[model samples]
Target: MPATPAPAEFPEDLTLGIRELDDQHKTLFAVLDRILAVSRDPYRQLDDDGTNTVLDIMTDLKDAAMQHFDQEETLMDQRDYPGLDDQQEAHERFLDDLVRIEADLMNGTAVPPVRLHADLADQLAAHVREMDRELAQFLNKSEK
Candidate 1:
């Protein structure tokens, strides 16, 4: 049988010109891949251990993302970036969605559906393409 390909890394174009934020973005994608690997395995059973692993991955992603946002916010404050407010709003919405899902998981109100993975992937892509890319452009322009 042919070996399965590894998950794709974050693309080069998404770099925001800032080393720290770019590194965080790359790490976020790695973390996402890690989550998918654990959850989507063919033999992964939906038992307590499997569920806890998912929760742990999600929590780790949340913490890393929030920390990235804080560093980005600090950079924006230093540079007086005009889009800081909008970025904060986007960050808030993203984190809020994560918290809601985590809460549901913890309370056993709803099981994590397979589609949840796709939804998260889609959201992250759109956020990076629209919001993060835009910020990168602004910062790049500022450098000129």
Candidate 2:
């Protein structure tokens, strides 16, 4: 029997209290968790099938992130959020990093699945805590 993959942790503090953004965030983390499960064994390298699975998950993550960012940026734009530019830059950087990782994995370069998952999860959580938190506050205030 195969062992179950561990789910990625999304801290409570990372919650931005926006339904759409929060839902998207959960989707993003779930994708990352899938990666974690695929690479659950740190001592062993991923097999070809595992590599393919990770690649697919990466694509899904990127797609989800792009859609989420679009919605988020649109919201920010609608409200004239001052941090929109910075948020966009950060989103672009993250997508670029994902592309690079995908290329590396496709070219037979080894990227530890667990570490990759952790890094992605941490980066996203930090972004939510710092940037998205502010955006949430601004958005909530604007809605009032």
Candidate 3:
């Protein structure tokens, strides 16, 4: 797989007020960036050595995602946010899907790194634009 260049800049408007969640989001982006980098440089193919790095990054992303979701859900629970259940369900579904993907990758049944990287980037971009942005707005308004 050829290496893709990391975005010159991540979209700044995605920031949520929750510090930990925001940090985890940033870390997720960083992992995506690394994957992109690998995609752009074919020499960085996901072979034995590169596979571990990719898997490690993916694991980190999964962990961070779980933590962020947990924090968000807790905040929602504390405030009795109207959409808490729906949001939690979304988080659960995302984690389940991610875990499956990770398992496939580890088992050698998944697509190549470049394709996976592209898919993840697209998925995350859409997720931030829609779900996360809405969540942040909801929280902000609730706080006020």
Which candidate has the top score in TM-score?
Answer: 2
Better of 2 and 3 by lDDT: 2
TM-score for all predictions?
Answer: 0.81, 0.91, 0.79
Query: Candidate 2: which pairs clash?
Result: none
Q: Write the per-residue lDDT of candidate 2 for residues 98-139, one digit (tens) a residue.
A: 999999888877667767877888999989999999999999
Best of the two (1, 2) by TM-score? 2
Query: Candidate 3 deviates by what RMSD?
Result: 2.8
Error of 2 at 38 (Å): 1.6
lDDT agreement of model 3 with the native? 0.70
Clashes in candidate 3: how many?
9
**Candidate 1 structure quality by residue, lDDT tens digits, 1-144:** 223236656776676676877788888777766655654442333456666777888898899899989988888888788889998998999899888877776776634434456566678777778887877787878889
List where candidate 2 sits over 4 angstroms from the true fold: 1-5, 40-43
Query: Which should have the higher TM-score, number 2 or number 3?
Result: 2
What's the lDDT for all of these models? Answer: 0.73, 0.87, 0.70
Please, what are the lDDT tens digits per residue for candidate 3 over residues 10-59?
A: 56766666676677777777766675454335334366656666777788
lDDT of 1: 0.73
